[model samples]
Target: MNPMAAMKAYAAVQGGGMPTGGAAPAAAPGFGEMLQNVMGDMTKQTRAAETQMTGAIQGQSNMIDVVTSVSSAEASLETVIAVRDQVIQAYQEIMRMPI
Candidate 1:
Protein backbone atom coordinates (compact mmCIF):
# COMPACT_ATOMS: atom_id res chain seq x y z
CA MET A 1 0.00 0.00 0.00
CA ASN A 2 1.01 3.66 -0.47
CA PRO A 3 2.78 5.37 2.39
CA MET A 4 -0.05 7.75 3.24
CA ALA A 5 -2.56 4.90 3.32
CA ALA A 6 -0.22 2.90 5.51
CA MET A 7 0.23 5.90 7.80
CA LYS A 8 -3.53 6.36 8.09
CA ALA A 9 -3.90 2.68 8.94
CA TYR A 10 -1.15 2.88 11.53
CA ALA A 11 -2.70 6.00 13.04
CA ALA A 12 -6.05 4.25 13.28
CA VAL A 13 -4.42 1.24 14.89
CA GLN A 14 -2.74 3.54 17.36
CA GLY A 15 -6.05 5.19 18.30
CA GLY A 16 -5.23 8.47 16.57
CA GLY A 17 -8.46 8.47 14.61
CA MET A 18 -11.40 10.82 15.18
CA PRO A 19 -14.97 10.39 13.99
CA THR A 20 -15.62 10.45 10.25
CA GLY A 21 -17.66 13.35 8.96
CA GLY A 22 -19.79 14.13 5.90
CA ALA A 23 -17.40 16.91 4.96
CA ALA A 24 -13.66 16.86 4.91
CA PRO A 25 -12.00 17.88 8.12
CA ALA A 26 -10.64 21.40 8.30
CA ALA A 27 -7.11 21.79 7.02
CA ALA A 28 -4.80 21.02 9.88
CA PRO A 29 -3.49 24.00 11.75
CA GLY A 30 -0.16 25.33 10.50
CA PHE A 31 -0.29 23.37 7.19
CA GLY A 32 3.26 24.07 6.00
CA GLU A 33 4.36 24.99 9.50
CA MET A 34 3.17 21.59 10.66
CA LEU A 35 5.81 19.80 8.57
CA GLN A 36 8.58 21.84 10.11
CA ASN A 37 7.12 21.26 13.55
CA VAL A 38 6.92 17.52 12.93
CA MET A 39 10.50 17.35 11.70
CA GLY A 40 11.62 19.24 14.77
CA ASP A 41 9.63 16.94 17.03
CA MET A 42 11.11 13.86 15.33
CA THR A 43 14.61 15.19 15.83
CA LYS A 44 13.89 15.80 19.49
CA GLN A 45 12.48 12.31 19.91
CA THR A 46 15.48 10.73 18.18
CA ARG A 47 17.85 12.62 20.42
CA ALA A 48 15.88 11.51 23.47
CA ALA A 49 16.04 7.91 22.22
CA GLU A 50 19.78 8.13 21.73
CA THR A 51 20.19 9.53 25.22
CA GLN A 52 18.09 6.70 26.60
CA MET A 53 20.16 4.12 24.78
CA THR A 54 23.40 5.61 26.07
CA GLY A 55 22.03 5.65 29.57
CA ALA A 56 20.94 2.05 29.25
CA ILE A 57 24.40 1.00 28.11
CA GLN A 58 25.90 2.82 31.09
CA GLY A 59 23.53 1.03 33.49
CA GLN A 60 21.40 4.11 34.06
CA SER A 61 18.22 2.63 32.57
CA ASN A 62 16.71 -0.72 31.58
CA MET A 63 17.93 -2.25 28.31
CA ILE A 64 14.55 -3.43 27.06
CA ASP A 65 12.89 -0.02 27.41
CA VAL A 66 15.81 1.70 25.73
CA VAL A 67 15.83 -0.75 22.83
CA THR A 68 12.11 -0.41 22.15
CA SER A 69 12.10 3.40 22.28
CA VAL A 70 15.22 3.73 20.15
CA SER A 71 13.90 1.41 17.51
CA SER A 72 10.58 3.21 17.33
CA ALA A 73 12.23 6.62 17.11
CA GLU A 74 14.58 5.45 14.38
CA ALA A 75 11.72 4.02 12.37
CA SER A 76 9.73 7.24 12.66
CA LEU A 77 12.66 9.44 11.64
CA GLU A 78 13.44 7.25 8.63
CA THR A 79 9.84 7.34 7.50
CA VAL A 80 9.82 11.15 7.72
CA ILE A 81 12.99 11.42 5.65
CA ALA A 82 11.64 9.05 3.02
CA VAL A 83 8.43 11.04 2.73
CA ARG A 84 10.35 14.33 2.48
CA ASP A 85 12.57 12.93 -0.28
CA GLN A 86 9.57 11.69 -2.24
CA VAL A 87 7.88 15.08 -1.96
CA ILE A 88 10.98 16.96 -3.13
CA GLN A 89 11.45 14.61 -6.07
CA ALA A 90 7.82 15.00 -7.09
CA TYR A 91 8.10 18.78 -6.91
CA GLN A 92 11.26 18.78 -9.01
CA GLU A 93 9.69 16.50 -11.62
CA ILE A 94 6.65 18.71 -11.84
CA MET A 95 8.80 21.80 -12.33
CA ARG A 96 10.51 20.09 -15.27
CA MET A 97 7.24 19.32 -17.00
CA PRO A 98 6.26 21.59 -19.93
CA ILE A 99 3.23 23.80 -19.50
Candidate 2:
Protein backbone atom coordinates (compact mmCIF):
# COMPACT_ATOMS: atom_id res chain seq x y z
CA MET A 1 0.00 0.00 0.00
CA ASN A 2 1.01 3.64 -0.41
CA PRO A 3 2.78 5.13 2.59
CA MET A 4 0.00 7.52 3.54
CA ALA A 5 -2.58 4.77 3.39
CA ALA A 6 -0.24 2.58 5.45
CA MET A 7 0.22 5.34 7.98
CA LYS A 8 -3.52 5.78 8.35
CA ALA A 9 -3.99 2.06 8.73
CA TYR A 10 -1.29 1.90 11.37
CA ALA A 11 -2.70 4.89 13.18
CA ALA A 12 -6.09 3.21 13.25
CA VAL A 13 -4.54 0.05 14.66
CA GLN A 14 -2.75 2.07 17.28
CA GLY A 15 -6.08 3.52 18.37
CA GLY A 16 -7.45 0.09 19.35
CA GLY A 17 -9.35 -0.49 16.15
CA MET A 18 -9.54 -3.16 13.51
CA PRO A 19 -10.82 -2.52 10.02
CA THR A 20 -14.43 -3.37 9.43
CA GLY A 21 -14.30 -3.01 5.64
CA GLY A 22 -14.55 0.77 5.64
CA ALA A 23 -12.65 3.93 6.46
CA ALA A 24 -12.24 4.59 10.14
CA PRO A 25 -13.48 7.70 11.90
CA ALA A 26 -10.98 10.44 12.48
CA ALA A 27 -9.14 10.15 15.76
CA ALA A 28 -7.11 13.24 16.39
CA PRO A 29 -3.73 12.71 17.92
CA GLY A 30 -2.83 14.55 21.11
CA PHE A 31 -0.78 17.70 20.53
CA GLY A 32 2.39 16.26 21.99
CA GLU A 33 1.97 12.96 20.19
CA MET A 34 1.29 14.66 16.86
CA LEU A 35 4.36 16.81 17.25
CA GLN A 36 6.44 13.81 18.16
CA ASN A 37 5.27 11.85 15.13
CA VAL A 38 5.89 14.75 12.80
CA MET A 39 9.33 15.27 14.20
CA GLY A 40 10.13 11.59 13.88
CA ASP A 41 9.04 11.45 10.24
CA MET A 42 10.94 14.63 9.48
CA THR A 43 14.08 13.24 11.05
CA LYS A 44 13.74 9.98 9.16
CA GLN A 45 13.25 11.65 5.77
CA THR A 46 16.02 14.14 6.41
CA ARG A 47 18.38 11.31 7.24
CA ALA A 48 17.39 9.42 4.14
CA ALA A 49 17.91 12.47 1.94
CA GLU A 50 21.24 13.17 3.57
CA THR A 51 22.31 9.62 2.88
CA GLN A 52 21.29 9.94 -0.75
CA MET A 53 23.14 13.25 -1.09
CA THR A 54 26.23 11.76 0.46
CA GLY A 55 26.10 8.86 -1.96
CA ALA A 56 25.72 11.20 -4.92
CA ILE A 57 28.62 13.34 -3.78
CA GLN A 58 30.77 10.23 -3.50
CA GLY A 59 29.70 9.07 -6.99
CA GLN A 60 27.87 6.09 -5.47
CA SER A 61 24.43 7.29 -6.52
CA ASN A 62 22.94 9.40 -9.29
CA MET A 63 22.55 13.15 -8.90
CA ILE A 64 18.96 12.97 -10.15
CA ASP A 65 17.97 10.54 -7.40
CA VAL A 66 19.63 12.68 -4.73
CA VAL A 67 17.92 15.83 -5.94
CA THR A 68 14.55 14.11 -6.14
CA SER A 69 14.86 12.68 -2.67
CA VAL A 70 15.89 16.02 -1.20
CA SER A 71 13.04 17.85 -2.87
CA SER A 72 10.51 15.25 -1.82
CA ALA A 73 11.68 15.43 1.80
CA GLU A 74 11.57 19.22 1.72
CA ALA A 75 8.05 19.16 0.34
CA SER A 76 6.88 16.68 2.94
CA LEU A 77 8.35 18.80 5.74
CA GLU A 78 6.69 21.92 4.37
CA THR A 79 3.34 20.13 4.19
CA VAL A 80 3.62 19.01 7.82
CA ILE A 81 4.49 22.53 8.96
CA ALA A 82 1.65 24.02 6.95
CA VAL A 83 -0.83 21.58 8.48
CA ARG A 84 0.39 22.33 12.01
CA ASP A 85 0.12 26.04 11.35
CA GLN A 86 -3.41 25.70 10.06
CA VAL A 87 -4.46 23.64 13.06
CA ILE A 88 -3.01 26.20 15.45
CA GLN A 89 -4.66 29.04 13.59
CA ALA A 90 -8.00 27.25 13.74
CA TYR A 91 -7.70 26.81 17.50
CA GLN A 92 -6.80 30.45 17.94
CA GLU A 93 -9.76 31.58 15.86
CA ILE A 94 -12.09 29.33 17.82
CA MET A 95 -10.78 30.77 21.08
CA ARG A 96 -11.45 34.30 19.84
CA MET A 97 -15.03 33.64 18.81
CA PRO A 98 -17.87 34.23 21.26
CA ILE A 99 -19.23 30.89 22.47
- The top-ranked prediction according to lDDT is 2
Per-residue accuracy of model 1 over 36-81 as CA lDDT, tens digit each: 6557667776887888988987999888889877876777688678
Number of clashes recorded per candidate: 0, 0
Superposition TM-score, candidate 1 onto the true structure = 0.64
lDDT of each: 0.69, 0.75
Model 2 scores worst on lDDT over the 10 consecutive residues at 1-10
What is the C-alpha lDDT profile of model 2 across 42-76, one tens digit per residue? 77778889999999889999989899889868876
lDDT value, candidate 2, whole model: 0.75
**lDDT (Cα, 0-100) at 93 in candidate 1:** 100
Inter-residue clash pairs, candidate 1: none
TM-score of each: 0.64, 0.64
Query: How well does candidate 2 match the true structure, expressed as C-alpha RMSD?
Result: 5.4
